[model samples]
Target: MSISFLAKHPVPCSLFLLGILVLGHGAYIQAKAYLAQFLIAQAWQQTLDDQQVHKPWQWADTYPVAKLSFVTKQESIGFKHQVESVYVLAGASGRTLAFGPGLVLSGAKIGEVGNTVIAGHRDTHFANLAAVNKGDLLQVEASNGEILLYQVVNTQIAHQSDTQFMAPSDDNRLTLITCYPFNQLSGGAEQRYIVEALYVNKPSAI
Candidate 1:
């Protein structure tokens, strides 16, 4: 009956279909984000197994470089039912960031003696970052099976043009960046939420 009605009212049916797609766009993007991470984790595991970079998909321009563990806990890999961690992909470009947080190429290399910057979408992966407070421990697992630990030192809100927050540092540090005002529903935010953590010399139970 619905198909017959659509056949008789093609224009109206088309409009209704488009409206449904428009309304579901947000959910589609979110579902894609999580699904992409599952594929990305597979690639990351392969990267670690083979000691080489692997793209999550054949057309993906970026590859996962490190696994970021936000909440300190014993979480097994393999995309668990409740995952608190994310795989950080290479390059902070829009296309790369859509799937997961991206590592800024201008920043220092991972696990190096300099600042490493990572950025993500506020509505998705980085939303939980707002809950991250100073003194919280974050763990980054590099592709080489080395775990780099960091202790959050500061959390600040800054204008988007403030490049100083992502600037290279002599001291080993990790900078997590996302659009400011996490509650904002629109895009083109002029501010950024910054989370800076200093690399811990010793590793914790994370």
Candidate 2:
């Protein structure tokens, strides 16, 4: 409260300030991520309307390429269901993943019969991937207004360096990749959680 008190307990005061800074930074990051998604959603709407790429922000280097959705609940054919979705950006760079999942540039095209790879932060966008299981359904709404359906066929964890699952393939598949150990707060995780889904059908015509 006073200079005397701070000087008397410099270590404690310093630790207290450090703690506040850390918490403030974390809060700022979360706020930014949430706000960015709202803007990205608007841009996605424009892209869908014009069939063109639209950046969420003027300074952003990425644009929405697809919308990825995961079926959260399906009680029965007669009942309604719930789904969770996030916009996929153009490239999987660190800057891009901070806001939403990003599409791997080297991977196959979004709605095509190939490996469509996407990466997101475990704590944010792809956090739900941890609950996903084989046989679950995933949907991709491409920029062209085409909705493609996919059924999860596998879920695996591999070392971060393993890139086999992310490589391009001839079959119609969707690969969702996120860091392993979803609870970990640090950015560098040594493992990866991957959800692989196969193209099942076109839920509707564009």
Candidate 3:
């Protein structure tokens, strides 16, 4: 039926149509959030939490860097983990090595003896991450059940060409990365935003 004709019908019909539109939009958003959460949690469980197949790096171990599941937001699903590429140290143009949804980048490795650098996709996997603010608690779930806590220290923006954002620091650090101009349209993100956190003492796992 024509929309205008339907609108001319009884009040009940108009109310019902409005209800459908509202409910449908609500359902779509809820479903999308659930799916994102499920995908990320599953990835962490299967790859990082699998006792028989995977083990996290020891606190004393160094090198390739330990991949840990990062959870925040106090939400059912936090976000994906990623591995930091040592090559990010190599002149900045090389692609930073990373795995999606299941690995935490060891910030202790990016510079000569400084902050560890890590990155994640902003649109699908780390969208809610933009909500993360300074002082938000972050947990890095390792296979050993030892979850490390980090406190957000700062957040900033950098161009795609600004490699200094990934430069190693003198202090122990954690950097969470996602595409920037957070309000921009989907097709082309013009910049990048980074949330830097400091490694506080280890906290109990959630």
TM values, all candidates: 0.82, 0.83, 0.50
Local distance difference test values of all predictions, in order: 0.86, 0.86, 0.53
Q: In candidate 2, which residue ranges exceed 4 Å CA deviation?
A: 1-27, 73-80, 202-206
- Candidate 1 lDDT, 1-206, residue by residue in tens: 37799999999889988998987997897788778878999999998998898999999999999999885323342221223788899999999888889999999988988889999999888888988877677888999999777877889999998899888889999999999899999889999999999887653332
Q: Report the number of the highest-TM-score candidate.
A: 2
User: Native-vs-model 1 lDDT?
Assistant: 0.86
Candidates' RMSD to native: 5.1, 3.8, 10.9
Q: Runs in model 1 with CA error above 4 Å?
A: 2-31, 72-83, 202-206
For the record, the alpha-carbon RMSD of candidate 3 to the native fold, in angstroms, is: 10.9
Between candidates 1 and 2, which one is better according to TM-score?
Answer: 2
Span of 10 residues, lowest total lDDT, candidate 1: 73-82
Q: How many residue pairs clash in each candidate?
A: 0, 0, 6
